[model samples]
Target: MKFDVAVVGASPAGLSAAASSARTDARTVLIDRDLTSVPNANTIFEGMASAACLNVEPFSIHQVRGMRLISPSGHSLEIDAGGHFLDRKGFYAHYLNSAADYGAEIIESEVRSVSRSADGMELFLSTGDVIDARIVIDAAGVDSQLASSLGIKTMRHPDDVAWAIEVDVRHPGIGEEDRFEYWVGSIAPGWKATFSPAGEDMATLGVFVRRHGRDVQRFLETFLKKFISRRAGSHPGLERMRILGTRRGGDPIAVLPGRIVDDGIMVTGGAAAQSGLAYSMRAGEICGDVAGRAALERDPSRERLSEYSRRWWRELGFEYILGRASLERLRSMSDDEIDRLFISLSGRNLLVPGGLWRKSANAAFQLTKAMPSMLPRFLLNLLRF
Candidate 1:
């Protein structure tokens, strides 16, 4: 098979790229395993909201408006109350359909390797089919084969890949009043636990721990049961409670591997390491859009299409830096120390950090604003290097 551009991974980024490519007048072929198993795959999540944020709609950013940040011991803080809860599967389907509507052909095959030819790049798939394209885009998610085939290392560290097991919770007590709560603890210290509505009587529940170490299943069982039991206190019954389905997987956050392009090759999406809160979906859209244009223009070098990196940087580079640093700090922090630190920052409407020393600057401003009385805990946290 031959095309103008070929994309691997049929998920968010791949689908969006296909749509964008076709819209830009390129003959795009998208390859991936199978979408039928997504709902059951460890990756597809339930209770993941489908509502897009109204204010950010124009920008195509995906995130819940409000997130309830809870301390491991059960303290809570809410932020971005205006973000949308995403229906991840629905969103994926919406884009996949759009790509077809826009004229991209969907090829349900797994890519095995990339060999550049005189005319274009030759992609060898698992089924022994050879696909030649003017440009091959790697939009595959965390488990990106195309990115690695081109010698891009995907794993930054063992801890960069977050591991988790989620169950479709049928607990009666989890309700609208529950809000979207993210609980921080040893099981998932860097991030928070999320419990959002799955249906009238249930919610989707999951936990994430550092990619480094944890008995993932044991931790999930222990914490989930405890959470359900505590929240279900005084409820009519626990006998009927059950987990509808189980999902377990990891998503690694890291920079793109090596070069994003070589020969007739180009990369995009998470494969290009464009996963973050504000830029995740936008990465796909931008990648697809750019890849299509590059194919149409027949310019596949790092020089002509180097704009992909810039696009993501504009949307996420700085904020992602803070998140990355915070994630690192969480990994190295003692649980007790972290508990105390969160307690201090909770509920404070201080300025959000804007740069590398963002944390320090914000802390200083907070100290100045609340002087004399002295925020002892906050001061102690600020003191910690």
Candidate 2:
């Protein structure tokens, strides 16, 4: 069958691309390996901070806000994260449903390869089905094997991918209002355990690491037990809850990749390496919108597909870049240093980097609070740098 654009992965990015493409009256086909969830999207997205959902702010997340960040060093500072924790299942269902509703056909099958065509591209799927489309949208996340074939770097920088393991545990202490707590200390290297409210009567406990590290799941499990043992010992609700399931891995927290498209194919979402945790929680809609327009224009050329890249750049790229860079830079620091610095950017604190000029006053205050003991040493590092 022929299509205006064949999106290879019906997750947030693929579906969004399909919806966007269909909106342009393009014959879009969305395909996935799993027949059930289409792209077989699964994960326990717990403990959402207001900052993670910034890209879609003022839109679906109409009334969302960020609060203070608590550091492991026993310091809490006020700051604004400016995002929303998603109603995860609702978020996915909403977008996937939107794509289907927009006259887009979503199929369950996997593509083997993309053969060149005079007009654009030919996708050969395992089902012996040939989908001829002017453009192919690769919204497949993480192990984007197809994207790598097109010369796009699908592998995230070593420090970018975080191996995670989470338990859909029910905790009484963590309620809807108190669902966000990030534990970062020396107990875990290059990672932290997160405690978040999944929804009413449910919560999730998980942990992650920047790159190849020790067993993250072991630490996560240990932390989960300790956290639960300490907090839920007396709460009757904690014992009543049964572990529904466990989810792990496939999160890339890094800079958004460049060249999401090449030749006649375009990439979006995770396949384009669009910060997994960030996009999984938000930004799929805009990414889909961008890829959809490119397909509708039927400009399968690299230049045309590059527009999709720019579209995300204006829409959600900046925030992703800033957030990714900030996190990456923070990851390079020592654990003690991180704990100390996070205390400054916490709760509605309005952290901004205007260099030493505009933020001089705020910097002064942070210096005092962040380094009461190592004032001279800290100033020396800042001065030398």
Alpha-carbon runs more than 4 Å astray in model 1: 39-65, 187-192, 213-215, 234-240, 253-259, 276-278, 350-385
Best by TM-score: 1
lDDT of 2 by residue, 102-137 (tens): 988988788888877887889888899989988787
Candidate 2 versus the native: TM-score? 0.77
- Mind giving the per-residue lDDT tens digits that candidate 1 earns over 302-329? 6666677677566555545545554554
Give, for candidate 2, the lowest lDDT window spanning 10 residues.
38-47
